[model samples]
Target: MNHFKIFSTAAATTLLAPAAMAQGIDAKVNEAFATVTGPFVNFIFAPIPGTSFPWIVLWLVAAATIFSIYFGFVQFRFFGHAIRLVKGDYSDPNDAGEVSHFQALATALSGTVGLGNIAGVAVAVGIGGPGATFWMILAGLLGMASKFTECTLGVKFRNEYADGSVSGGPMYYISKGFTQLGLPGGKILAVLFAIFCILGSLGGGNMFQSNQAHAQIANIVGDYPGWITGIVFAAIVYAVIVGGIKSIANVTEKIVPFMGILYVGSALVILIVNYHLIGWAIGQVFAGAFTGLGVAGGMVGALIQGFRRAAFSNEAGVGSAAIAHSAVKTKEPITEGFVSLLEPLIDTVVICTMTALVIIISQQLIMEETSGHYLMNEAGTGIATVGGNTGVALTSAAFGSSISWFPYLLAVAVILFAFSTMISWSYYGLKAWTYLFGEGKTTELLFKIIFCVFVVIGAAASLGPVIDFSDAAIFAMAVVNIAALYPLMKLVKAELDSYSARLKSGEIRAFKH
Candidate 1:
């Protein structure tokens, strides 16, 4: 058999194995995948000379910072305006788009607010220390501008179909926007972006979400075969994506709001109950931010972890949200930009910070008294776990210490989060897939079938090089994406200027009842 067939068969067997051996199978599969994926991870995450920050993090941070300055901190200036746009302030009944601004925001949020918040933050704090939380907030703040720039370009350059369907994203913007500017490398960047997005959609967006979701499920119920969870989840995902079923997507979108609110609310309650240590936790986060110990580069270690996790969680500069926001029903592209800036804020700053605080306040990472609240004697190292686990399990333990039953609810939320995220990413991957393969029923169904099968593979496997490689693929999109952003950002800024001029002059008035 060919490699794909052989690997798929092996994955199927591993996942279907007995529970006692399933976890081992997971590790072995992960190792096998890791052996191949390790080089890519090393290249992507390799530290700078005498520092721990990866070039990818710096690439994204640079884009975010430049845009924040170029737009005069538009993320801040347009903050209120974004809220209004999402509230349909300037919506028209005759608008030509597939979804409303609110729907677009919700859809984008659903894609991003998944395992990264649940498991990624734990990984960050687990290794980089609580100080990582501080830098994550900063990255999220700066990342808003990148979101604004890309989503605006996404809509501005989108291809509106004859049937009112729209396809917009970095691909559209990179190809078309560069063409408009007489730029030489737009097509190259766009094509590269689509390729990475496909890989990312399968790995980080699809498999990583499935893997973590399964892990959370196993945490709750008795340990069953990972393949069992994977197969069931994959079937459900296949049903939603294969038939172009809008109803399932609608149901998912609706359920996501409830799950999200409850999850955040639960985080707040965990904090509120531990009010006594809130300051100490905050102090720990702040202190560790500057002078974190242990780890390779001290302060840089914390910076890297915080920025990496935030970028992964919010996807501000990666251009995925541009696709989701492009579907918003608005004539002006800048409005979508405004609306999208809120994504990273909510995902990384608000929600992610809450998770960090809980982990810190729980004192779960304190290896000793001298380690401080969020600090560890050694930085860049994971703390010892009672269950000898990391990722979502660590997050669960931190919360369970505060609320014993929270794990059950968290499992439900994780599944829901995974479901909604997968559905969103399925659309993302489909767009990229069709971009490369062209649009047709057969082509579409082919991709969906492959996606469903991988979901099973992802859930049945363990976290290691496979997940790392997938995450790297997602960031690889950023490398090409930011290249396009530099040349195309001026177009977005011009749109922002016009939108502001019109709004200030009362020409962009709200719709009257």
Candidate 2:
């Protein structure tokens, strides 16, 4: 243990050495990255003509809504069965796939259950008021159908190799499902999706995670260069992801549960401690949803902010989870679909809602008497911060108010959340890379190396334009993925029907029994 500690300390020192030398480099890098990515970010996030709504968010919301209606609200109907499947009640060990149902869920959950659930939810509630929570929950419920559709297709169309490895996700499903439907340009659509997935993996999944994790650490420990934190995180992430999906799944299965318990348990403690305010906080959420609590644009502002943040937070319609879910050990592709729907529930409904409740109950936000608008901060600037704190720091303040030592715990949770997200996204990005290039160890290793390098960049620099562009790239994936889903959703429905019938007839019996 002593030897291990010494080596670890030495490694950390080596990593920090560059931070001291690279004092002025962050500004230069951020400026250059912003200049290069500004146009693409603007184009991707551009509002619909004559409207403030970003077309990408509209695209995701529309897909989720349509899928919910078309699937007959399958997310709700099969919600119980999803839980059973996750528990391995219907799993067959003989199934041809890389990981178990639970591990697959954990992996996908790791990707979406990151800074977004913490900081993003806080941001939504801050600007949109507590009422945003209602719309966010509503959107998350709708998104369940989108996840159900895409993941079923992911499993159905995946390619199993001779070495027992698999390659799947939007790229496989789009190309194969479209061809089966006699559609042209299937490969083109698949290619575009792959490119976007890779970019999203780098920016939102990798950089944003590392950036926030470093910020949280800095909040607790005095200021230091972000590159040091980035390098250490990159090294740790590469160790897990280098082993491929099965390895990533193994680590995530353990980390995700512990991370969830720690964060949620803390939230639960705060909620329980402030039990008296629970009803009042909930009332605020409902009132804010419709009245907007005097926020700008009233209910419309709350609606937009809630929907926008929920779409970003749960990532159900984004189709990234489909990539992770595709690796599940289930012959019945629809079983994974059932399992996938729970992602939005766990991510948005449970976790994001918890954060929102804590903020509301903590009285981090206040209503102005005359204007009736929610005061963003103590100074009443409408900036949606507490004492000039924003994002995770704002959330820290909320939690710290309830539990004095919670900020330290939150920093640890942030690091774990960020690390899990990076490893999972590394897999997502790798699959996309291998899809575009051929599958080979050498090619895969190159992509992994590049991914690790970006972890450092993300931590070290504040590339707002680059991060924005990456976010656009992530949503752009939904554009191609959901478009593909629309044409091929009937196939998923057919699979679901068959699976449900087989289970009813005892053809798909519970192996555990």
Top TM-score hit: 2
Residue-wise C-alpha lDDT for candidate 2, range 210-289, written one tens digit per residue: 87778778867877988899899989988898899999999999999999899999999999987877898888889889
Q: What is the TM-score of each candidate against the true structure?
A: 0.88, 0.91
> Worst lDDT window (10 residues) for model 2?
1-10
Q: How accurate is candidate 2 locally (lDDT)?
A: 0.81
* Model 1 stretches astray by more than 4 angstroms: 1-37, 243-249, 293-297, 364-389, 462-464
Task: Look at candidate 2 and tell me the lDDT of residue 79.
Answer: 94
Tell how far residue 58 is off in model 2, in angstroms: 1.4
Q: Candidate 1 overall Cα lDDT vs. reference?
A: 0.78
How accurate locally, in lDDT, is each candidate?
A: 0.78, 0.81
